[model samples]
Target chain A: MSMPYWRAAGMTYVGYANACAVLVRKCMKEPFKSQTATRERVHFKLSQWLDGVPQQPIVRTSDDGGGGGGGGVGKK
Target chain B: MASGSARPGSMRLAKLLYGNVNSYLSSGAAGINGGGAVWGSTTGLSSAELAPFGARSASGQIVRNRMKSVKSIQKITKAMKMVAASKLRNIQVKAENSRGLWQPFTALLGDAPATKVDKKLIVTISSDKGLCGGINSSVVKYSRALFRLNGLDGPDKDVKYVIVGEKGKAQLQRDSKKLIGMYFGETQKSSICFTQCSMMADEIIKSNEYDAIQMVYNKFNSVVSFQPTVATMLSPQLLLGDQEVTGDLDAYEIEGSDTKEEVLQNLSEFQFACTMYNAMLENATSEMGARMSAMENSTRNASDMLDRLTLTYNRSRQASITTELIEIISGAAALEG
Candidate 1:
């Protein structure tokens, strides 16, 4: 795939993602658009990722024979 | 017989006086008339004795030369204005496009709590080229105000600076030589790019000298208006510091093996680059806008000067022609007599 303009322009992944997030926030409609809290939440999340925050494990499977049954333990 | 002798003697004296006057007149004494009226009535005098008419032609030549120079200057100013206008349009679009990257980042920073730091780095953005109306001065003024507000004056001042552009460096060097940590002069030589911003960020980050960084730049408001603005970018320590951790921090979930510290470091670097890039874009746009207006003013002034010069040239030319005509008519009248 061709490099994106921001990347070609030397924007880091965090920078590019942050811009996309902001653009997304701007396009949100109605109640979602008016909700500053949600927008801030998105901004916060995007910033965290942009800051290179490590991804949390989505599912932590138990190793004690209850593996499949306790797979959803780390969900937040 | 005695009366006859006396009359003859008187006539001889009269003839001698006339001969002396004729000789003087032939020697170009008519030039001393000072343009009032050439003594064209003296048959012994030549038309060359009319020095004022010749001087008028010389004066006309000087006026024509001045008008020519003004016309060339007007052409140059008009071309410069056109070039600036086109550049302004392109830069404005770029500035607008980059808004998305920085606006949200700004909002996030805005909500964060302020953490006081001892050593602050201020980055002043301006362009090397001037003749733009106070564009560089505005940033310089903003930086000065920042120093004053933070009490960053005198020997004990803890503020440091990273100045981008020769204009800002030259201005700030007068007062803040000790405070300038680094200077970037090449960015304004050509259009600024993210690579330049990255290089600047690396320098600032590698120095590991300051607690926080602030960018002072001219923000493009419109073609005719711009304002010096300050955008603060927190250092890694400040970004991850407990004091700056807001309620919004709980909304994000990190992934992978990277620790918060690593993430913060990377984030700070990325944010630094982004912020610098954004500031550069805005400053570039503002510079172009300022230049466009400045060039427009110059072009207008040049045109005004050309108009005035043309009027003077025409008037002088007409005056010379009238003088010559009067001289020729008087000379002809003298010849007829």
Candidate 2:
């Protein structure tokens, strides 16, 4: 039996839609990879900024806490 | 999936038939069709002040779009898997029960009436579009394999095909040389057509035109997966590849509805109608399931992309701020000097 002409067009449209959809995904994939790279760069920059700050001394003295030891520590 | 199978020379003829869609995708390339989502609004509090979701031109925008699109696809696939599962449950039940019925029916009748074989036809049913993974392609390949077995590639093979859905039409239309006839839009009709499908079947069966008939369709196995399978429309023996077994007689019952022979006589039609009815429901459910999964994946991807974009915007703004601050301090020190 023969089918309606419109149905053929409709089916074609579906193919058209699928074809479009698939190609779109193919196009989107490359850009997505770029986005990942950009994100990684941002993280790299942030880490650099944190590393620029000062660092604490490896060792410390107790006398520094007494403010030059103006007053006696053991005897009144 | 229109025909539940792929077309001959599909790879070679890709441009001839599906070229229109290729053009359409190109036209929409700037957006999701190309590589990016709509830039959307970059307005409001100025945290990042990126353009609107639909307005951006940067890679960030494309990233957002792609992420969203992929997530949606995953969601759709997942859902399709589930739907196929439920539909599979019902279909499998029917298939199991019908197998028993078909066994006896075929045994009694020996073989479906060959009336007057002349015309050759193959009807393949698939969705208009494709999103489900291998559901359509596998069926198409299966159909092609059958034709190959039947010597369609040989000079003597004069077979004709009538596709039942959009996907099948696409594949067939691409490979026009092999085609003898076309039937489109059977699925778009108001209902799963036993009457129409049977009419089509009757045309071939009653006329004895076609030597054999086959259907390639997605058989739901579980909620997460579906198998595209080929079922024989004529000569189940072809698909089943089994030897005919002639056994003893077992009479059927019929009070007012006529005897078992009556039903058995219509069994071919009955089976055709049942196949069409069940396939319609199952296919729809599977389609919806795939779409649902695709959409959910898109949503998640969009959110992730937005997060990354916001981070970039903030860092850029902060860098600009720090530069200004350092300049201001240096200028003041110069005045003091």
Please tell me which predicted candidate would have the highest lDDT against the true structure.
1
Per-residue lDDT of model 2, residues B1-337, tens digit only: 3122224445545554355455555665555543323222111112243444444344354445555664565465455656545654554554445345334434443443222223345556667666544555555676666555656345676566655566665665565434525444534333332223333333334333455555556655554566665554443233233233212223333456443333333444455444554554455445444434443454455456657766776666567679889999999999999
lDDT of residue A8 for candidate 1: 67
Task: Tell me the tens digit of each residue's lDDT in model 1 across A1-76.
Answer: 3444554664544444444554666677878866632222210010001122322312212223321211121122
| Clash count of each predicted structure | 8, 45
* TM-score, cand. 1: 0.66
In model 1, which regions exceed 4 Å deviation? A1-76, B1-54, B111-115, B152-156, B242-246
Query: What is the C-alpha local distance difference test score of each model?
Result: 0.64, 0.44
In candidate 2, chain A reaches a TM of: 0.25
Fraction of true contacts retained by every candidate, in order, equals 0.01, 0.00
Candidate 1 accuracy as lDDT: 0.64
